[model samples]
Target: MGEHCDDEQVVVKKLVNKRYLLFKIDLFVLSFVCLQYWINYVDRVGFVNAYISGMKEDLQFKNNDINVANTCFTVGYILGMIPNNLILLVAPPRVWLSFCTFAWGLLTLGMFKVTSFEQCCAIRFFQALFESCTFSGTHLILGSWYKESELPIRSAIFTSSGLIGSMFSGFMQVAIHDSLNGVRGLEGWRWLFIIDFSITMPIALYGFLFFPGVPEHSSGKSRFSMTKYFFSEQELQYARRRLPARDESTRLDWSVVPRVLKRWHWWFFSFVWVLGGENLSLASNSTFALWLKDQQYSLSHRNNFPSGIFAVGVVSTMLSAVYLYKVARSRHWHVATFIAVIMCIVAIMIRANPIKPSVMFTAQYLGGVAYAGQAVFFAWANIVCHDDLQERAIVLASMNMFSGAVNAWWSILFFAATTVPHFEKGSYALLATSISSGLVSVWIRKLQNRDSSRKQKLSYIDANDMLDEDDDDDDDDDEYDDQIAQNHS
Candidate 1:
C-alpha cells in the first residue's frame, strides 16, 4: 500500500511539474517571441503605411521608390538570416535576440528623421539586418522546448501575432494620422515610428530579463542566469530530457556545411520555402493597398481596407494550426496543398479584372490563406530535422534566407509598385508558384515516407539480430547442463 501510494504521488508530481513548466514557457518565452515578432511586423509595415499616408509626398517619391526600399530591406534581411541564426549556436539567444530587438527599435525610431528616398532605403537596409533574427530564431527556440504535439499551435499563435500586428498597424496608423499628425511639428507618419519604438523597447527589456535560452545551455551557472529564476533545476533537466534525442556531438563549425549540403533536407525544404515565400507576394507587397490607392480611395480607407486581408490571414493560420495538431498530426502537406488550390482560385479571380469591389475584396482576402504555409512548413521542418541541432538551425535559416534572396528580385520583377490595380503578370506568377509549392509539398511527403520506412527496417533487423544472440546463449547453456549431468552419472 505504501509503495502504491508513493508511485501515485510521483506520477502526480510529474504531471504538476510539466504543467508548471509549460505555463512558464508560454508566459515568458512564447509571449516574448510573439510580441517581438509582432513589433517586427509593425515596424516593417510602418514604412508602407507612412508611404501611403504622407511620406511619398514629403520625400518626393516616385512609383518604384517603394520597391527599391523593399528590395534593399530584403537584401539586408537575406544577408543577416544565415549568419544571425548561426550566431545563436554560440551566443545565448536571450542576449542576442534582445540586443537585435533593441538595435532595430533604435533604427525604427531613426526613420522619422529621413529626408530623402536614398536615406530611407539606407535605414531600411540596416533595420532589416537586425530585424531578421526573430522568425527563424523563435522557431528554433520553440523546437528546443516544445513537443511535436505542442509545437504547431504555438507556432500558429506566433505567426498570427504578426498578422495581428499588421492589422493593428493599419488601425494604429489611421489613429496616429488622425490624432498625432502635425503635433510638435512632426508628420503623423513620423509619429508612427516613434510610437513603434516605444512599443518595441519594453519587449526587448522583457526578453533580456526573463527569456530562457535553449535547454542544452540553460544552466544556472551561466552569466545570463535569468532562466534560473524562472525554472527550477529539476524543471530545466526535464526540459532537456523531454525533447527528442539529438546528436550532441554536432557542432556549428565548418564540418556542418558538408553535413548539411549532403542531405536532402537542406535542398528540398529550402526550395519549398523559396516557392512558399513567393506565394506570399500578393499580401506582403501591399498590393491590396496599392489597388485601393489606384482606385482613389480615401487615406483611411486605403489603410483600413487592406487590414481585412490580414484579418483573413489570422483566421486561416489559426485554423490550419488547429487542423494540423488535432486531425492531420504532422501531415502538414495537406494544408499546403489546400492553400495552393485556394490561392490559384484567388489568382484567377483577380486576373479576371472584375469591376466590382466585392470581387476584388474576396480575391484579396482569400490570398491571405497563403500565410498559413508559414506555420505549417516551418513546424514540419522542425519535426523532420529534430535529431540534429546544427542541421535544424541551418535548415530553418536557409529556408528563410534563400526565400528572402529570391523575394528581393521576385517582388521587384513581378509585383512592382507600378503594377497596381490589375497586376496581370503578378497574378500569373502567383498561380505558377502556388502550384509548384503544392507539388513540392507532395514530393517532401514521399521522401519523408521513404526515410521512415528505412528507419523501421533498420530497427527490425537489429531486433532480430539481438533475438538470435539470445537463442544461441540459451542453447549453449542447455548443452553444458547435460554434460554436467553425464559426468555426475
Candidate 2:
C-alpha cells in the first residue's frame, strides 16, 4: 500500500510540473510567437487587403498587377528562409526576430510613401526579405518549447493566430476605410500601412523584451531579466528530458547538405507543403473577394465578406488542432489531408457550375477548412525532425521556402488576379493539387509508420538476444556447481 501511494504521489507531482512549465511557456514564449505571427500576417497580407480596399485604384494598376506584386513578395520571401532560419542557430530569436520585425515595420511604414506599382513592388520585396522568418522560425521555436503530444494544439494556435491577423486585417481595412480615408489627405489603404507599423512595432518590442531564445539554450538574461528563473531547476530538467537531445552550435558546414539530403524529412515534408500550399490555391487566389469585387460590391462588402473565409480558417485551424491533439492524435493525418481534398472539390464545383453567388460564397468559406493542413503538416514535420535541432530548423525553413518558391509561379499560372471572378483554370488546377497532397500525405505517413515499426522490431530482437545470453550463462553456472558438489561427495 505504501509503494502504491508513493507511485501515485510521483505521478501527481509530474503532472503538476508539466502544468507549471506550460504556464511559463505560454506566458513568456507563446505570447510573443502568436502575437508576432499575428502582426506578421497583418503586415504581409496588408497589401491584398488594401488592394481591394483602394490601392488598386490609387496606383492605376493594370490587369494582373496585384499578382505580379504578390509574386515579387513570394520571390523575396523565399530567398532568405533558409539563411535566416540558419541564423537562429547562432543568434537568439530575441535578437534576430526583433531586428527583423523592426526592419519590416520600417518597410511597412515605407509603404505609406509608394505612389506607383513599381515602387510598391520594391518596398514589398524588401519587406518580404525581412518578414520571411516569421512562419518557419516560430514553428521551430514552438517545437523547441512544446513536447510532441503537446505540439498540435500549440502549433494550431500559432497558425490560427495568423489567420486571426488576416481576419483582423479584413475588418481593420473596413474600419480604416470608413474612418481614416482622407483623414490625413491619404487613402484608407495607405492608412493600413500606418496602422500596421503601429501594431508591428509593439510586437517587435515585446519580442525584444520577453522572447526566451530557445528553451534548451536560453540566455541567462532575457531582456526581461527574470524569465530565466520562471522554471524551477527540477522542472527545467524534466522539460529538457521530455524533448530529444539537441546540440547547441554556431557552426555552418557543407556536411549539412548531405545530412539533409539523406533524410526523408527534408525532401518529403518540403514537397508536401508545396502541395499543401497549392491545395490552398483557392483561398490564396482570393476568389471570394474578387467575386464580390466583380459584382461591383462596395469596398466594405468586399473586405467584410472575405473576412468570413478567414474567420472560418481561424476556427477550423483550432478545431483541427484540438482534434489532432485530443482525438486523431496524428495516426490519422490522412484524415486531414482528405479534408483538404474535399475542400478543393467544393471550390471546383462552385467554380464549374452556375451556382448562386451565396452558394459559391459558402463553398469558398468552407474551403478555408483546407488551411488546417498548414497546422497539421507543420506539426508533423516538427515531430519527424525533433531529434536534430538543425535538421528541424532546416526542414521547417525549407518547407516554407520550397512552397513559396513554387507559389511564385503557381499563383501566376493558376490564381492570377487578372483571371478573377470565374477562375476556371485555377479551380481545376487546385483540384489536381488536392490529389497530389492526399497521395503524398498517405505515402509519407505509411513510410513513417513502417520505420517506427521496424525500430520497435529491432529493439525487441535485441532484448530477446540479451535474455538468451543470460539463460546460457545460468546453465553454465548450474554445471559448475554440480561438478563441485560431486567432488565434495
Candidate 3:
C-alpha cells in the first residue's frame, strides 16, 4: 500500500512538473512568437493604413498602383516562404526568426523615406521577403512544442495577435495622423512606418534573448543559447517526450522534396489554402476601406471604420478556437464550412447592392469570421503532419507559399482598387472560392479518415502477428517438455 501511494505521488509530481514546463514554454516561446507576429501584421497593414491616410496624395498614386505594390509584396512573400521555413532546420529558430524580424523593421523604417510609388513598391518587395517568415515559420515552431490537444488554443492566440495588430494599426494610424502628421517633416502616413519599426525591434531582441528553439536540437553550446537559460534539462527532455514520436529516418535534405510531393498532405493542404486564401478577398484586399473611400468618408473614419473588420475577426477567432478545442475536437472542416457560409452571405449582401450604411457595415464585419480558419486549418495540418518534422515544416510553408503565389494575381484580377464600392467580379470570385474551399475541406476530411483507418488496420495486423509468434513459441516449449519426460521414463 505504501509503495502504491508512493507511485501515485510520483505521478502527481510529474504532472505538476509538466504543467510548469508548459507554462514556461507559453511564456518564453509562445509569447515571443505572438509578439513577433503581432508586429509583423502591424507593419504589413501599416502600408494600407498609410495609403489611405496621406501617402496616396504624397506619392501621387494612381489607379492599379496599390494592386501593383501588393502584387510585388506577394511575389516576394512567395519567393521566401519555403526557403525560410527550410532554413529553420539548419539554423536555430531564435537566431533566424529574430534576424528576419530586425531586418523587416529596418526596411519598415526605410519606408519613411520613399519618394515615389515605384520606390515604395521596391521597399515593400524586400520587406515582404523577411515578413514572410512569421506566419508559417511560427506555425512550425508551435507544432514543435505543442501536443495535438494544446495546439488549437495556442494557434488561435497566435493568429489573433495579428488581427489585434491589424485592429491596433487602424487605431494607431488614426492617432498618428491626428498628432504626428507633420512632426519632424514627415507625413502622418510615414510616421506609421517609423512607429511600426520602433515597436518591432524590441520584440526581435526579446525573441533572441528568450525564445527556445526546437526541443530536439536545443543545446547549451550554441551561440545564442537561450533555450538552456529558459528550460531545465528535465523539462527539455519532457518537452521532447511529450510530443508525438517523429520518424527518426526523415532527414531535411533534397530527398524531402520528392517525399513531400508524393504525399497527399502536401497537395491537399496546399490546394486548400490556395482556395482559402482567395476566400479572404473582402477583408484581406481592404475592400471596406476602398468602399469607404469611394463614399468619400473622412480619413479618420476611413481608417477607424475598417478596423471593425479586424475587431470582429479577433472575437470570432478566439471563439472559434474555444469551439475547436473543446467541442469540435479539431474537426477544422466544420469551421471551414461555417466560414464559407458566412463569407458567402457577406459576398451576396454586398453584391445585392444595398445602399444602407448599416447593411454594408454588417456584411463587412461578418466577413471577419473567415479569419477563424487561419488557426483551425494550420492546427489541423500540424496535427496531421505531426509525425514528420520536415514534412510539417514544408507543408506549413507550402500552404502559405502557394496561397501567396495565387494571391499575387488573384487580388489584382478580382479585388483591384478600381473595383471597389461594388466589386461585382470580386464578389462572384469570392463565392466560387468559398464554395470550392468548403468542398476541398470535405475531401481532406475523407482522406484523413482513410489514412487513419489504414493505420488502425496495420496496427491490428501487427498485433495479431506478434500473438501468433508467441503461441508458436509456447507450443515448441510443450513439445520439448514431453520429450524430456519420455527420455526420463
Candidate 4:
C-alpha cells in the first residue's frame, strides 16, 4: 500500500511538473527569439538615428544616398532569404543561426568606421544578409514547438518584440547622443553602433548554448528534449517519426518543392503578407520619427512620441493572438484583418488631410495595430500548413521574401526622401493596398475553410476502415513524396 501511494505521488508530481513546463518553452524561447529580433531592429535603426545625429554630414552622403543604402540592404535581405531558409533545413538553427547572429554583431560594430556612402552601403548590405535568418527562422521555430491553437499570440509576441526594439532604439539613441557624443574621441554615431553591437553579443552567446536546433533534431538534455514540450502525445510521436530509423538515411528530397507550391494556401499567405510587410516599413523603420525630425521637431519629443506606436502594437497583437487562439478553428482571421485594414485606411486619410501633429501621431499609433495583423496572418499560415513540413517552410519564406521584395521598391518609390510631412502618394497606395488586403484575407479564409471541410470529410470516411485506409494513405504519401522529388530534380 505504501509503494502504491508513493507511485501515485510520483505521478501527481510529474503532472505538476509538466504543467509548470507548459509555458517555459514559449516564454523563454520566445523571449530569446524576441531579444534577437529586438537587437536586429536596433542595429538596423542605429544607422537611421546616426543619420539624424550627424552621420550624414560626416559621411557626406548625397540626398538620395541614404535611400540607396536602404534599398541595397533590402536587396541583400531578399536575395538571402530563400537560400538561407534552405540552409536552415540542412543545418541546426542553433549552430547556423547563432553564427549568423555573431557575424552580424561584428559587422554592426564595424559600422563605426564607415566614412563614405559606399562603405555604409556595403556594411548595410552584408548586415542584412547575415540578419535575414532571424525573422522567418523564428516563425519556423515557433511552429515547431507550439500547437496551432497556441501559435498566433506567441508569434505576435515575437513579432512585437521587433517593434519594441524599434521603440527602445529611440530611447537608447537619446541616451547615447547625450552621454557619448565625444567620449573617447568617438562621435555619437560611432558609440551608437558600438553599443548596439555590445547589446547583441550576449544574446548570441546565449543562443549558441541554448537554442534547440530543430524540433526533431534536439540534442540530449536541452529545453525541448523532454516529451512534455510537445502539444500532444501524437505530436511527440510525429516528431519522432520525422527522423530516420537506424536502417534509413536522411537526405534532402528536392521533390518537396512542388508539393509545397501546389497548395493554394501558400500563394494566399504570400499575397497577404506582401501587404502586411508594408505596414512594418511605414511604421517600424523609424520613418515616422525621421519624418518628424526632418520637420524640425525637438529630439526629445521625437524620441518619446514615436514609441506610442509600439505600445499600440503590443495591445493589438496580444488581443489578436487571444482572439485567434480561441476562434481560429472557426475561420475568424478575416475579422482581424478587416479591422487592421480599416485602421490603415484611417491612417492614410489622416496623412492625406492636414492635421495637428498630435492628431497625426494618434493616427499613426492606431495604424500600428495593423502590424499585429501580419503576425496573426503568418501564424495562421503556420497553423494551416502545420502538418506539411516542406509546405510550412516554403510558405513562411515566400511570404517574407515577396513582402521584402515589394517593400524594397515600395519604400523607394512611395516613401522617398521628398515625400516627408505628408507622403500623399504613399498614403494613397497604402489606402489601396489596405482595402485589397482585407478583401484577399476574406477570400482566403473562405477557401481555407472549404479545404478544411473537405479534409475533415475524408478523415471521417477513413476512420470507418482504419487499417485499410491507413495503409492506403501511407502509400499515397510515399507516391506524393516521389512525385515531389522528381519535380525538383
Candidate 5:
C-alpha cells in the first residue's frame, strides 16, 4: 500500500509538470504569432513613415506616384494570398510562415537601397507579395487550435498586433527622424528600413522552432492537452461527438476551387472585408496625415494624431469581442456598419469644418472605433464556415485577397493626389460600401438560420430511420437464432 501510494504521487507530479509545460508552450506560440503580425505591419507601413520623411524628395515622387506605388504593393499582395493559402494546406505552417518572414525581411532591407520612384514601387510590390502569407495563415492556424468559443478573443488578440505595429511605427519614425536623419550619411528613412528589417530576423527564427503547426500534428503541446487529466474512454467518446472528423484518405486537391468559387458566403464576406478595408485606408495609407497637413495641422501634431485612432481601436476591438461572445448573437453586422457609416459622415463633417483641429481629431478616433469590425467580420466568417475546414480556410484567404485587389485600384483612382484633403470620390465609395456590406450581412444571417433548421430536420429523420432498422434486425436475428438453437440441442 505504501509503495502504491508513492507511485501514484510520482505520477501526479509528472502530470502536473506536463500541464505546466504545455501552457508555457501555448503562451510562447501566441506571443510569437502576435509579434510576427506586428512586424509584418510595421514593414508594410514603414513606407508611410519614409514618405513623410525625406523619401519623397530623394525619390522625386509626385503625389500620384506615391499612390501608384501603394497600389503596386497591394496588387502583388493580392496575387500572393490564394497561392499562399493553398500552400498552407499541404505544408507545415511553421516552415512556410518562417521562410516568408525571412524573405520579406530581406525585401524590406532591400528598400534602403531603392533610389527612384520605380525602384521603391518594385521593392514594395515584392515585399507585399511575400508578406501576404502571414495574416491569413496565422488566423487559419489559430482556428485549428481553438474552438468557436475561444476564437473571438484569440482574433482580438491577433488583430491587436496590427494596431500596436501601426502605433509603434509612428513613434519609431519620430525617433528616427529626430536622431538618425544624418547617421552614417544615410537618411532617417533608410534607417527605418534597416531597423525594421533587423527586428524581423530574430522573430522569424523564433517562430520557425516554436509555432505549433496544425492541431493533431502540433509538436509543441497546448492548453487543450489537459484532456489527459480528466478524460477516460467514455468521456473521449462524448467529446468526439462534438468534434469534427478527420478524413484519412483526403488529398490536397485543388479541383474544389470551382465549388469554392460558387459559394455566396465567400463572396459576401469578401465584400464585407472590402468595406472593412476602406476604413483601414483612413489609417493604412499616409493619406490622412497628408490631408491633415494640407489643412494646416503642424508636423508634430500630425505625427501624434493618428496614434490615438489605433489606441481607440484596440479598446473597441477587445470590448466588442467580449460582448459578442457573451451575447452569442449575430447582430455584429448592424453594430459594425452603423459605426462605419457614422465615421464616414463624421469625416465628411470634419472635412467641411474649415477651422477646428479638435473636431477632426475626435472624428478620427471615432472612425477607428467604427473600423474595429474588420476583426468581427473575419471572426464572423470563421463561425459561419466552421463546418468545413477546407472551405473555411479558402474563404478566409478569399476575403482578404478580394479586399486587397479591390483596394489596389480603389485607392489609386478614388484617392489620388488631386483628390486629397477632401477625397470626394473615396468618401462616396465608403458610404456605398458600408450600405452594401450591411445588406449582405442580413442575407448571410438568413442563410445560416435556414441551414440550421435544415440540419435539425435531417438529424431527426436519420434518428428515426436508424431506430426502425435496429428493430428489424433484432426481430430477424432472434427468430432465426431460436430455431438454430433448438436444432443444435
Candidate 6:
C-alpha cells in the first residue's frame, strides 16, 4: 500500500507538470495559430466588405466580375495547398507561415494601386497563395500539438475564430465607412485595405517571434532553442512522451504517391470536404450580403446584415464541436450541414412561393449551421490520421485543396452575386451537394468501422514480441488504437 501510494504521488506529479506545459501551449501556440486564422480570414473576406462598402462603385465592377475575381483567389488557394504543406515540413512554421502572412498584408495594401479588374485578380491570386497556408497548415500543426481527445474543441475554437473575423470585418467596414471614408485622401474602401495591412504587420512580426514548431522537431534546432524559455527541456520531453512515437522523417518522394493512393483516408476525407464546401455555399459565398444588395439595402445594411450569419456561425460551430467532441466520429460531422440543407430546402420553398422578407431571411440565417462543419470534418481528419505525420499533412491540405478546387467554380455556378434575389439555381445546387455530402459522411463511417474491426482482429498479435533485438521496427498500433478510443475525453 505504501508503494502504491508512492506511485500514485509520482503520477500526480506528472499530471500537474503536464497541465502546466499544456497551458503554455494553449497560450502561445494555439493563440497565435488562432490569430493567424482570424487575420487571414479578415484579409481574405475583407474584399467583399470593401466591395459592398464602396469598391464596387470605385472599381466599376459589373455583372459577374466580383465572382470572377473571387475565383482567382480560390485558384491560388488550390495551387498553394501541396506546396505549402511541403514548405511547412522543410522550414520552421515561424518563418514560413509568418512570411506568408506578411506577404498577404503587403498584397492587401497593393489593392490601393489596382485600377482594373485584371490587376485586382492578379493581386488576389498571389495574396491567396500566401494566405492559403493559414487553415490547413494550422490543422497540420494543431494535430502535432494536441491529442485526439483534446482537439475537437480546440479545432472548434480555431475554426470559429475565422468566423469571428468574418463577423468583425462587417462591423469594421461599417465603422470605417462612417469615420475613415475620406481620411488620407483615400476612399472608405481603400482605407479598409490600408487599415487591414496596418493590423496584419504586427501580427506577422508576433508569429515570427513566438510561433512554436511541432514538438518532434523542436529540440536540438538553433531556431527552436529560444522556445525553451516557455517550456523546459523536461516539459518538452514529457510533451513527446505523452503522445505516440514519431514516424521516421523522410524526404518528399514518389514513394508517398502509392502509399496515399492505397489508403482510404486521402480519398474519402478529401472528397467529402469538396462536397461539403460546395453544399455550404450560402454561408461560404456571403449569400446574406448578396440578398441585401439585391434588395438595395444601404451600405450599413450590407455591412451589418451579413454579420448575422457570422453570429449564427459562432453558436453552431461551438455546439457542433461540443457534440462531435463528445461523440468523436466523422459520421456525425454532416449534421450541421444537413441542417443547413434543410434551410436551403425551405429557402427554395419560400422563393418558389412568395414569403415575407423576414421568413426568407430567417432561413438564410439558419444556413450558418453549414459553417459549423468546418471544425467537425477537419478535427475528424486529425483524429483518424493521428499516427502518420506526412499523410496527415497531405490529407489535411488535400481536404482544403479539393474543396477549393470545387469552389473555384462553385460560386460561379451557384451563388453568383448576380443571382442574389432568388438564386433558384444555387438553391437547387446546394440541395444536391448537401445530400451528396451526407451520403459521403455515412460511407466514410462505414469504411472506418470496417478498418477498425480488421485492426482489432489483428491487434492480438505483437509485432515487437517477434522482432529481434536492436532492429528498427514499427510501433504496435493496437496500443495506439486503444489510447485513441479514450482520447475523445
Which candidate ranks first by lDDT, i.e. highest?
A: 1
TM-score order of candidates, top first: 1, 3, 6, 2, 4, 5
Tell me how candidate 1 scores on lDDT: 0.86
Better of 4 and 6 by lDDT: 6
User: Tens digit of lDDT per residue, candidate 4, span 108-131?
Assistant: 999998778999899999999988
lDDT of 2 at 135: 89
Candidate 2 lDDT, 1-489, residue by residue in tens: 999999976644442234456788888888888898899889987888888887888889988888889889998999989889999888887889989999999999999889899999999898999899888998988888776666778888888888888889988999998899999799899999999999999888877877777766675455454456665444555556555444555235776788788979899999888988887767876767877888788888888888787788888888877666555223546555766567666756776662478677778888888878878888888877776778888999999999999999988898777776667777777777787888888888877776666642211121112222233433453343334322211
Q: Over 4 Å off in model 4, which ranges?
A: 1-17, 221-252, 326-332, 456-489
lDDT tens readout by residue for model 6, 1-489: 999999976544442244567788898789888898998888888899988887888889999999899999999999999899878987888788889999999999999777888899999999999988989999988888876656777998999899999988888989988998888778888888888999899988888777777776663345643576677555665565555454566446777787677999999999988877876677778777877877889999888887888788889888876775555353454564465466557546546742357866777777777777888888888877765777888999999999999888889987787786787787778777777787788788778777766653323232223324322232443344455454331
Summarize candidate 1's per-residue lDDT along 414-468 as a digit string, tens digits: 9898887778898899999999999999999888877766653211121112222
Range of the 10 consecutive residues with the lowest summed lDDT in candidate 5? 458-467
lDDT of 6: 0.78
For every model shown, what is its TM-score relative to the native structure?
A: 0.90, 0.87, 0.89, 0.83, 0.82, 0.88
Query: How many clashing pairs per prediction, in order?
Result: 0, 0, 0, 2, 0, 1
CA deviation > 4 Å runs, candidate 3: 1-16, 328-330, 456-489
Return the clash pairs for model 3, or none.
none
List runs of model 2 lying over 4 Å from the truth.
1-16, 222-226, 229-237, 245-252, 328-332, 456-489
How does model 5 score by TM-score?
A: 0.82
Q: Total clashes, candidate 2?
A: 0
Clashing pairs for predicted structure model 6, backbone only = 149-487
lDDT assessment of candidate 4: 0.71
Angstrom error of the Cα, residue 410, model 5: value is 1.0
Tens digits of per-residue lDDT for model 3 on 319-385?
Answer: 8878765662347788899998988898888789745688789999999988888898898899788
